[model samples]
Structures are given as structure tokens and as C-alpha cells.
Target: MNTLQRRNAIKDELQNQKLISAKKLALKYGVSRQTIVGDIALLRAQGQPIISTVSGYKYQEAGTAYHGVVVCQHTIEQTREELEAIISLGGEVVDVLIDHSVYGQIVGTLGLANQADINDFMSRVKNVNHNLLASLTNGIHLHNISCSDEKVFNSIQQRLDDLHFLYHD
Candidate 1:
């Protein structure tokens, strides 16, 4: 396929598959992974609602979902539990934000919406041996959560509070 065709195909694939990696897209289109990355960049530049997550790229449509940011502080060992608590209460961990000493604010797109996504993220955390963004700030960070309503977000907040994960003065 031509460049325009391949990029269009990539957009369609993202919409259909929900989440896919550049490697997978490259394999599917018989192109280099870099080429797929370029395609994704071009697509994003064109205002496509595509988001790259820890797992892969997924199309994110504008929605009426309630979004809230919660301050949290916990150990690395509590990462899974924190995420689980949020996901179990119908909260999507949209992203993690941390204030770095050098960099002002760093945001990591998580896109963790379920148990499976949490599992994959935990696995990657172990396998990648990379420090989570929170580690930089002594386990203090902010999570932008998306939920169906304020009620669900409240439940998630309560759960995190119960788990001693919510940071408060």
C-alpha cells in the first residue's frame, strides 16, 4: 500500500482493534517499525484521537466520562494494589503525573481500564526494570482517573483512601 493508504489503514486498525503496537502494525503492513511510528505521528498530527499507552496505541474518542485527578502516595510494592483498587471500582487510570525536580511535570499515559490492563502493566514494570515515574518523587504522584460518573470516582477515591494510598495533609 502507498503512504496515505498505509496511514489510513493504521487509523482503521486502531479504531477496530482498540489497542495495537507499532511492531504489530509493522508486521501487518510489511513495513519497518519506524515507518509505522512515522505513520502514527502523521495520523496524530492530523488530529486523530489516538493515544499511545504502556501496552499499545488505542483510539480515544471524546466522551462524557467524568475525569478527576487524585493525589496519591505509596510504595512501588503498592502500585498494583492501587491500580487494582481503582479498576475494581470502575475507574480508568488515564495517566500518572509527577512533578520532577528537574522537569516540571511529567505525564505517563497508562490507559489502564481493567484487570487485564493492570496485569500487563505490572508485568511490563517487572520485565522492563525501569523505575516508575512516581519513584522520582518518593512515591508521590497524581492519577487522572476517568469514570462513568462522580459516584464511581468517589468510590475509587474512597477505596484508595481505605488502602492508605491517597495522599492528604
Candidate 2:
């Protein structure tokens, strides 16, 4: 099969399965890792909504349900406040995503659910000489948020809206 065929097949597999790794696709398509990367780029350029997480590539299709992405902007000091609001609303702040001119979407999984978790995460970031995802973009970042119910989700949204931290643009 050709590169285009291989890329299409990979996309189909991802849409059916939850995740797929580059190595698996490379082997299946009898191509190199670089070729797989190029194919992924091609697929993305064609407007395929794929998320490259630490586990693997995930395909987002229409009608397929997902939690949500909430874009918010705030000063670095407000990080804790934002996290607190989400946690208080019973939502999980899954990961932080920032757009990088070079690396595309830079995502870091915080997996934080409460104030103590946030404190530990902040400490780690400070000690590792790394900045929060929002800090990389001057206090603008997208949070992948999830909750058990619409009520919780709405509550979090309301809290964020009240705080003037939610950015819809």
C-alpha cells in the first residue's frame, strides 16, 4: 500500500480503537517512524481531529462524546484559584494544553483534583525548572476538564465565568 493508503488505514484504526502508537502503525504499514509522523501531520492537515497524548494518538469523530476543553486566561498567580474552582465543582483537571509555535500543542497532564494535588504539582514544576503550561503562553491555556454530571460542569463554568477567567475566543 502507498503512504496515503497507509495513513487512511491508520486513521480508521484510531477511530475504531481508543489509542494507537506510532511504532504499531509503522510496523503495520511497513514504514519508518518518520514516515508515520509525516502521515500523522498529513492527516491533521486534512482536518482530522487527532490528539497525541502520552499514551498514543486519539481520533475525535463527530457524534463521539468527549468531556470538553475549556480555554481560560489568567495571571500565573490565579492558577491555584482556577484549579480550586474546578475541584470545588467536582471536576477533574485532566491536563493543561498550550500552543507552541514550534511543537504545536504542548500538553502536560496535571491529574490534579484538589488543592493539595495542585500544591504538589506546582512544587514539581518549580523544582524541575519547568513552567506551567499557561505560563508558556503568558497565562493562556486550555484545560481538559471532566466531571460526573452536567450540574458539576455547569457549576465549574459558572465559577469560572464569575471569576472572569473563562476565555471563549
TM-score of every candidate relative to the true structure: 0.96, 0.58
Clashing pairs in 2: none
- Worst lDDT window (10 residues) for model 1? 56-65
Tens digits of per-residue lDDT, candidate 1, 87-147, equal 8898889999999999999999999998999999999899989899999999999999998
Error in Å for residue 12 of model 1: 1.1
User: Model 2, stretches more than 4 Å misplaced?
Assistant: 1-66, 127-129
Candidate 1 runs further than 4 Å off: none
Q: Which consecutive 10 residues in model 2 have the weakest lDDT in total? A: 59-68
Deviation of model 1 at 159, angstroms: 0.8
Candidate 2 per-residue lDDT over residues 18-118, each given as its tens digit: 66778888888888988988888889999998866534577753442336678899998788789889988788787889998778999886556567777
lDDT for predicted candidate 1 compared with the true structure: 0.92
Specify the highest-TM-score model's number. 1
